[model samples]
Target: MQFQTFSSPHTDRPNSVDKVMLQVILALLPGVLAMTWYFGPGVLINIVIATLSAVAFEALVLKLRKRPVMPTLHDLSAVVTAILFAIAVPPLLPWWLTVIGMAFAIIMVKQLYGGLGYNPFNPAMAAYVLLLISWPIPMTSWLPPAVLSTNPLDFMQIVSAIFTGSPPTGLEWDAITMATPLDGMRTNLDQGQMISEISQSPVWGDFGGLGWEWVGNWFLMGGLWLIYKRTITWHIPLAFFAGLTGLAMITFLFDPESYPFALFHVFSGGAILGAFFIATDPVTACTTRKGQLIYGVAIGMLVYIIRTWGGYPDAVAFAVLLLNMAAPTIDYYTRPQVFGHGDNHG
Candidate 1:
């Protein structure tokens, strides 16, 4: 009798690329809704604009490469990348820049190296960094949450602003735009303001910023859901939070007036989102369990260091990209011993 031979690592897994991407989209919805509530319809508009442009750019690239377009498009990887980039940028970022970002994300960062699973870096983050460095003003111009906005734009006004690069008839960009929580903290800290005094501002919350911490909470819930669903493991997120808060605690204890509380770091600017969503990108992240912990911790530490000292306010994109370059080396050293290959086992 003849029997079929299989590969060394074999299992019957039901998950597919499309299915995984779908779950990620579902996981992001709660956080997206919260952002919309606090920031207005611009969040949704960004998603729509990003989605359309990413699909188009990806299809164009695939056609140029003579690959099957529909199958790749069906996987929804482009859409996921698009959504991430959209949410990371200013809500009222001009439409053309969004298109440019998607083009770079899909074509240069994703497809140029190889598609999807083959790429070593996170496409969304690479594109985000590119846009940020290329156009600092628009990229950093975030708006005050609805509760604090002097004149919040309605749906029509938002659409106009995104397309036209101008707010409503009377309002200037300064009237609607304000620095992000992380930006505000960095700016105030640099100008000789105490953490306690900064926290007294209306935008400040119990931990982070008023609307920002809640957004982080929603993303945290979504991330936990992803873990429960087996869409992601807990190693990265846990290690990330541990590393970030651990460092924050050390500095905060030394000088309470200078450093914000540990939880402030946890609840601020992309920390929660980066921990679960971006850092956990299977393709770009370390695969071995031990490697993942190391990768997560390193990223967390880098984020704190860069945000505290570097020019950028939020350091998620920078930290993740930096570690992406190191993930292969991490995996190499952390690879587990084979069942029958180790000297002791033999």
Candidate 2:
């Protein structure tokens, strides 16, 4: 009798790319809710427009490329990219701007590069940068936080403002619009105001702006949840914060009058979200442990540098894209040697 070949049983797990993407989308809900509560219905409208546009563009591109559309659309990558793009952009921006940005993100950045795992840049960041460059006024026109707004916009007013560039009541967009904390800081610094003076302004509260600090903290909590769920590792977040804090501390020590404190850097702008969610993106980020640390630290340092010295008020998008370009090289250099490989002493 011939001996029969033995086969091991397949390991069962509930994890999939789609499931991971869904979890991330769920995690962003709290932050999105906070934004809507503070920023008004405009944010929700932006989300809807961007998400639908991204999905549509993704499907169109896939069909044009002769790829299976159903499976790819079900992956939820385009949805996540769109949501991130919407969150980063000004809620009151023109509806067409959102459509254009999402289309570029899905068609040019994500799909043109061969889709999800093949893209070398963060799709959302790429789209955000494109919009910012193309529409400076709209991109920068952020509404004052609800706590500070004299007249908070309703849903219809928001829709009208976005589509017509004016509220239904004929209110001027600039009256409701105000510079964000980071934008204020950048402008003040450019005007030769010291950090201490800028920090004392009405625009900045103890930690950050009126409602922004809370939003950032909520995102931080969600990020911690993502780590607890093992959807992302801790290396990138920890290293990113470490680099930011370290750099800020060094500058603050040297010139407290000119530089903001470490805590401000950690709590302000997109630092929390960038560290936890954006940098932790598995596709464009480095894979090895050491490479993750290095990549994160590099991003953090670049963010600080650009915010402090460069023209941009926030540098998360630029930093992430720059580091994304280096991820492959970082991974190769930082990969751990195989167990059986002999260590070569130089």
> Where's the lowest-lDDT run of ten residues in candidate 2?
1-10
Candidate 1 lDDT: 0.92
Clashing pairs in 2: none
lDDT of 1 by residue, 1-346 (tens): 4444497546654538999999999999999999999988888999999999999999999999999999999999999999989889989999999999998889998998879888989999999999999999999999898889988777899999999987789888988899999999999999999998999999998999889889999999999999999999999999998889889899999999888898988898999999999999999999999999999999999999988889998999999999999999999999999887878844
Candidate 2, 56-157: lDDT as tens digits: 999899899999999999999999998888888888989999999998888888898999999999999999899878788888899998988987777778
Model 2 regions lying over 4 Å from their true place: 1-10, 167-169, 343-346
In angstroms, how far off is 326's CA in candidate 1?
A: 0.2
Over 4 Å off, model 1 = 1-15, 343-346
Poorest stretch of ten by lDDT in candidate 1: 1-10
